[model samples]
Target: MTDTAIQTRQREIASEHLLFKLIEYVEDRHPGLLDFLEQSLDHLGDPADDASKDDAGVRAIAQRMITGARRQGTD
Candidate 1:
């Protein structure tokens, strides 16, 4: 694949991971979170602006995941 294709695929994976984490975090409070996410799947993504800026949304997820891991003593 070309560099652009690889970048786009990586961006899509990162967005999917972030969305998965979000639903996992809120599933207890919102019982239908998974179903909602499945129905509104297109809503998840690293936005075009953020993607242009080097996947800032994914970076944010990395930071949050680190914080959460540290808090739970899993880091």
Candidate 2:
């Protein structure tokens, strides 16, 4: 596969991993956290979307997820 295609696939995998981790976290702690994450993810739109490939956009989405997870973990 092309490098770009490979990178996209990797990002998708990472996103899935993050989603799984979020779900696991909710199961272990606060159920409401999942709802917040789902809202955040929805706001992020499709990872494969052209705008999502922009470096800043990707970082923003990842950062948001990480921040949400960290906040949930601490609570």
lDDT of 2 by residue, 1-75 (tens): 999999999999998777857565665676575456555653553347554466556557656665666655632
Q: What are the per-residue Cα lDDT tens digits for candidate 1 across 1-75?
A: 999999999999898667656656676556665455445434445656633654546555555654453344311
Which stretches in model 2 have alpha-carbon errors above 4 Å? 32-75
Residue 8's C-alpha lDDT in candidate 1?
100
Q: Tell me model 1's lDDT, rounded to 2 decimals.
A: 0.58
Model 2's TM-score against the true structure = 0.40
Candidate 1 lDDT for residue 31:
65
RMSD of 1: 11.7
Give stretches of model 1 more than 4 Å off: 35-75
| Per-model tally of clashing residue pairs | 0, 0
